[model samples]
Target: MIGANSVLTLAVNIGIAAISYVMTIRMIPRFREMFIKANLYGKDLCKKDEKVVPESLGVLIGCVFLVAMFFFIPIPFTFGDAASAEVATTGGRSEVFPYKEFVELIAALLSICCMILLGFADDVLDLRWRHKLLLPTIATLPLLMVYYVNYNSTTVIMPKFARMFVGNTLDIGIFYYVYMGMLAVFCTNAINILAGINGLEVGQSIVIAGSILLYNTCEFLLQHQLDAHLFSMYLMLPFLAVSLALWKYNRYPSQVFVGDTYCYFAGMTFAVVGILGHFSKTLILFFIPQILNFLYSIPQLFHFVPCPRHRLPKYDSNTDLLTISTVTFRAEELNFIGKQMVNIFRFLKLISWKDHADGRITTNNFTLINFVLVIFGPVHENIVTYMLLGLQVICSIVAFFIRYPLANLFYDT
Candidate 1:
């Protein structure tokens, strides 16, 4: 039995999503044209018949979402008609405006806007990996500070078994803040690294957002207190709508590249929801694929193996198939210890290598894209994109179930 206020909230959310969808769909073409005229185009590497496409069109998504949020978020109008202010009675107590919650929402929205700007800067400047990685840490500071100020509970409930050994809850204190900051950085960069092909960035984002929305809906229904999950849904639903609309031009045969703008914006939106809704742990569960991909690339990222600027799949113009891109390591580039590590990974088949006569060795770039190419052999670009997105969907579903029903077995849910 859902309440009237809940029903009204649902209706309002749907209306907002509808508006965002229509506006994004209509605005994409104009943004694409603007990007093209501005000479902000990048080569499409996934397709054999690739052409330069307008990039950084995520500006449209960011603008539309922010505008829609500001206009439609139902902030109370407390002008001269102060007595006409809406009120609701819960347990014989009258409730007015949720000032604190609304303020938190505003802070979160502002942080996301900052991330959008940071991402756009990366798009235009072609920032170094270190700069790109560190910038998001700065952009997310506002939201994290708000989280610290508003709700500073650093105590987490232990698992049922752990509770028996220790206590019901443990206070992590300031380490929690560091964890939250790392989570923000990881979320932003994880999606950034997983991108290359058409639609991959925005496509995985749609799947992740949809998964969160579904899980949040479940929590809202099952939990007696609805506010926390409702806050998450408010952000997630509109994000899904806008991303779906963006998917039109970002899909196979992509007309516009979303650039890093969409990735940072989308990732920050998820972080904002998790922080504000007090469910950051559950949010990480939904990012299983991104997490795995990040871990898989860490060695190359840290120079344990050679890394190229871009690890996009090799496109066979004649066969119209995508294959793994290889990275070559110079003999002088590795120490004895690093070569030993490389041999271990190669023997484990996590990587493959060919020693050349010119004192060089070539191995496949270690990324999820290359891994897919390895297992599936040469595949069409669209097929690879869809496969990756499908993998995301499956992983998110497993994560949702693990955090819900299966959670009861491990934790006192």
Candidate 2:
């Protein structure tokens, strides 16, 4: 059975999350006006009417999240543990300060704050892809430093197949930190790259956040490192709550755009919670869709194929369905090696392409959304969004299955 302090912590966290949700929902319409007056708006491309919508409203969400976190900071310490409670009750004449949790929490918040600024600046300044990609590395410095100083563990469990070859555990030392930094970069850019539809970004974030919550709740109930799970819960609950609020208006007929800020904020939230809560490995499992999307996009991401500024699905007005958007180049534009790679991928049925009489070749951009379109053909934008979100859920379920029943095949759980 859970104790009083644990129950109290739940109530307080839930309370703050709910309030933040309500605040975001209520403030969006008001913020929309300010955004429009400040010229922070963009025209919707997919729609025939080219509707105007407020942009960078995600900055508002990030600000509210930070404020809510400030209030949440004190509650965790007051109910953290016997030591924290004693220190709170006594004047600290002889009690030990709860330095570890305090520092970790502050560092996590600082890292998130930095990412928020990066995202906001990118939205305002239209930072180049190279610069935007590398900025996340700077934002993650605090998180890495905290991990190095507070709870550095460089060892990784060897898989069953490898255990016989190289024992049960292998220590890679500093490479682990490098891996975490890469994870932060991936987390920040994944949703941003995968976005185009109205609610797709926030919707996927909600699913991933909910998946993390489910796993953390299970771990909490099992009493497998309660403090860590609680920390995850505190970060995730508010994230899910605030995201749902945005989703209400950002769905099919979108009223506002989430922009780069929300994507970065959401990804950094997952990164921060996963790192601090000691479940970074498990956390990665929940991002299967994003991972697959990134892998499939390697060809286009590099100079192999000419990448466009916008890879979103084409909105066909004739049937009112979304179709795969393609990058077309003259047949001569592709060198022998690039053409060979394209032919190989086409033969493998990984992509679809068309040739025109004008001596040009066109192929779908490498993205999960386009991949689905290649399989299903044209469909409504909302239906496409649902299909991808459903895929995310399935991937998460597979992750849990692998983490639990199939554990013996992978590692010592």
Candidate 3:
């Protein structure tokens, strides 16, 4: 027979799952109503005066309620006889386990709350980018404090040359704090950016949640680390709940968007969990796609790329010294060259292109690149596993680029 703790866990999981399903069913009509109202408002406003239809109040309220409920359910860490006995048997630090679990759960809940608030503000009031950035950073303070208190310090990975040149210093205090802050911000933004399309962000979250669960399971099995497993399980429950709820409204022709709430929380969850579980390297490997997406989108955010003169006709010739007209190339020629560059990027499978007619083309040449990188990437004891990861990456890349481009072209056109 299962112990009381095990039975409680089973009950909690079932209750949460049932609540999620019921919430999803209840949310569908509300979502549909919101969608209809928004559409009607959008159409009427567009006819009279162009204005964006504001996101529904119902959705915002629902998100807030969910976030509140998550916090309200305080699942206190039980450092009971079993846990104490286990610690004694393993000769492990006694205080660390319960505290770590507590911190992680609190961090996850805090992160969720932050995301809900930020998401609500963005969805309803249409917050500026600067505010979004600043707000989330401010909101991440609790999680950061919890992390520092529990972990004591953040880990840093320096390049071999840098390490050799600088001599290993154990005292990285303020730097660690700043690094952690930056990580939280970056992850929050990465998730927000990737939430552009239906299922994309949610799918990524599912992948992350699954990877963390697997990693935690492995840690427990191999090292007899119950803390990691327990923390991961707690984190997974809410994520799985939210994913199911969001998926119902998010699956293609999305009735309701998870918006920044889900995105920010997803990123925060990954960051906090990784830090607590000491799975930084594995998390990095698992979230490579998100990393790639961030890398690709960073330049666009800065508007660093030079625009041709013809693209900006209002610029004074004298003031705008960087105008394409001042150069030898014509605007038309530059445009053509730009198009070619895009096509070339697509050909290389480094980027994607959407033509005016809605045709999409993506390059699939990166499969070989990924394979080579994997083969030479890490000297893992489990060479076969690394080999398999390489193969999966290559296969996924090829399938996505080759088929998606065609499908996108067909549907879009």
Candidate 4:
């Protein structure tokens, strides 16, 4: 049964979510103005003209989330039992200030804040892709340190097939930290890569956060579990609230841009929840679409195919439609190795390329957005966003089902 502290914790969690949402909604205009005044504007490449937009309003959401943390996180709460209540209340409120898990979560929050700053630096400096790749790894050090100090279980249960070959659990030892560090790097960059359209980054994040909220609720009610899920809800709810706020201005015909800051902030929230809440594997399942997109873009990313600075769809001012952005490269520019790779991609329908009479090869950029355009064939930007978000919802729902009911068929949860 739920106890008094649990009830209070729920009340605080729900209240803070509502408060954060309202705070973000009310403050968005102000933040946009601040961004404008600071000369932090970006050209919307999805438009034919260089449409300027106020950028990095995600700083508002990040700040609001951090400020909200200071209020509810330190309050003493427990999952179940009177002993937990004693641990919460018997000690003076002041004594509960330094609770271990709470400290860990706070550390995670600080790490995310640092990541947001790193993204802001990128927004200002326009860091190279190589530089951007390593910055998230640096930003995640504190989070990884806390995880190492608190819970260092590097053991992963072997799949049934793997178990057949080598029996039971496999301890990965030190590689586990490397795996987590890569997860942090991947989560941050994956969202950053699939971006360039209105609301795609924040929209997908909202869908993932909602899926996680549903999972946490299920664990709380169906499994009679708490703690970790409750902590997850604390992060997820605020993230959803703030992301929705950003989406308002970032949707079709956007008034402002969320910039990379939001991407890092959003991804790090997932990383923190997954790692600290002990559901990193399940959380990754929710990101299958992003992961698939990243995998699909690998050839272009490694320079076997040309990677553009902006992979946004071509914006036709006359039609006000976003179509595929085709890139052309001279045949000689692609060496024998690049030519063979392009042939493989074309056969897979992962790319559409043609050799012109002028000895230039033209092809659509390899990106989730461009791939969606290729499939649907030049729909409006809003329609494309809706379609992709629908796919994300479906993927997240299927992941949840796989982790829950189909556990025996898939492998143990």
Ranking by lDDT: 2, 1, 4, 3
User: Residue 375 in model 1: shift from native, Å?
Assistant: 1.0
Q: Give the number of the best model, judged by lDDT.
A: 2
lDDT of 2 by residue, 1-413 (tens): 55687679778999999999999999998899899999899987777787899998888998888888899998767775523533433664566557778888899889899989999999999999898779889999988998888879989888989988889899999999998898898998998988988899999999999999999888877778777888788888888888999999898888999999999999999999888888888888999999999888877787677789889999998888899999988867777767777888899898998889988888999899999999999989889999999999999999999777898567666
Model 3: per-residue Cα lDDT over 1-413, one tens digit each: 22466446545654665676566657665555555565522221111232233233324434633553464355333422223322322456444244455456667577657766676666567676787678667767887778777667654544444566655334577877776667767777766664433345565666567666765665555554565555556566656665766665554434555656667667766776665656544456665655665554332344322322122111123332111111122224334545555455456655322333333332211222222322353222123223333444554444335333543543331
Q: Which residue pairs in model 3 clash with each other?
A: 349-363
List the candidate 3 regions with Cα displacement exceeding 4 Å.
Answer: 1-11, 34-104, 155-171, 306-413
- Residue-wise lDDT of candidate 1 within 1-413, one digit each (tens)? 54556556666777888999998998888777678889889888766656889999887798889887787556322211222334768899987665566677788898899999999999999999999878878988888788878788899889888987879999999988888888888888899999988899999999989888888778777873366677787788888999999999999889889989999999999988888888889999989999888877877888877788888889998898998999887867887766776777778787667889998888888889888888888999999999999999999989988897899998866
lDDT of 4 at 271: 88
How many clashing residue pairs appear in each of the predictions shown? 0, 0, 1, 0
- The residue pairs that clash in candidate 4, if any, are none
Candidate 4 per-residue lDDT over residues 206-234, each given as its tens digit: 99899999989888886544777877887
What is the total number of backbone clashes in candidate 1?
0
lDDT of 4: 0.81
* RMSD versus native structure for model 1: 3.8
Which window of ten consecutive residues has the lowest lDDT sum in model 4? 77-86
TM-score of each: 0.92, 0.95, 0.61, 0.92
Off by over 4 Å in 1: 75-95
